[model samples]
Target: MENCPFCKIIERRLPADIIYENDRILVFKDINPAAPVHFLIVPKQHIPTLSDCHEGHTAILGEMMAVVPRIADMQKIGVVGSTPETRTGGYRVIINAGPDGRQEVYHLHVHMIGGPRPWKDNK
Candidate 1:
């Protein structure tokens, strides 16, 4: 954990553009963003990848899921309208598992991606 960038952020040893923080979790802007609105939600505890999670991590896992929506809303990325008639803008929550999943960070974290012009224009 000593050399972990996130750990350093948590310890206030490293600078992060923090968006949200609580006793159990920390949400911050991703240095290398894939979208205009991109942030990462990570547990304070160090757990390398989703595959590393076990029964003991249930509470933290649930907490992470529970906070995702709130964080999305905070970032102005939550579904604006949701009804049988129409559904407006929303966000994507991604958890890259391991090497095959393109997870650059070893620590388990969720990437929140959204914005009006989130996707790049190929044309």
Candidate 2:
């Protein structure tokens, strides 16, 4: 956990393009973006992988999910129109876990990808 990049970012040991933050979570732009709007949402606590999460993590997880729409709203990437027929934009949420999932960072995090461009192959 000491050398983890996300931990470093949380600790202010490394720099991040932080867009949002609070006591429970941190949101920042991805170093290698996969879409026009690609950002990461991570917990302040270090939970190595999605698989590591347990029932105790429920609240944090809920908070994480809750923040997504807010971020989407801020980015102007979700719900531009009122009705489903009139809806123009949306967002994508990705969480790669373990070796097979191609997770570059061990820390559990969500990749929020969206905007007006094509979604690329996320690394």
Candidate 3:
């Protein structure tokens, strides 16, 4: 984990466009964004991937999930209504587990992406 990019950012050894930081989590803009508003929510503690998570990581993981909506709100992303009649803009949170998931970074992190649907160029 010593050479991990996210760890370096947390240690202040590297630079990142950090948007938010808490004792357990760090949110920053993704250098290679897939959406207009793309950011990564990473746990300060390195936990290789979601598959590697254990009961000990529950609290931090829960906290991570709890903050996503607020972060989306901060970015002005509306709520994702369940009904078509109530359609509203919102964000998507993703966790890529392995190579098949296209997880370039080994550190466990959630990708928060908002702005438009169908992800214009990502398709």
Evaluate residue 91 in candidate 1 and report its C-alpha lDDT on the 0 to 100 scale.
74
Candidate 2 structure quality by residue, lDDT tens digits, 1-123: 888999999999999999999999999999998899999999999999999999999999999999999999999887688887988988898899999998999999999999876567643
Pairing residues by index, what is the TM-score of model 1?
Answer: 0.91
Each model's TM-score?
Answer: 0.91, 0.95, 0.90
- Model 3, 1-117: lDDT tens per residue? 898998999898999999899999999999998888999999999999999999999999999999998898888885867899897887889999999998899999999998976
RMSD to truth, every model: 2.1, 1.6, 1.9
lDDT of 1 by residue, 49-95 (tens): 99999999999999998998898888788886669568777778889
Query: Ten consecutive residues with minimal summed lDDT in candidate 2?
Result: 114-123
Name the runs in model 2 displaced over 4 angstroms.
none
What are the lDDT figures for the candidates, one per model? Answer: 0.87, 0.92, 0.90
Give the best candidate by TM-score: 2
* Candidate 2 clashes between residue pairs 3 or more apart in a chain or in different chains: none
Query: How does candidate 2 score on lDDT?
Result: 0.92
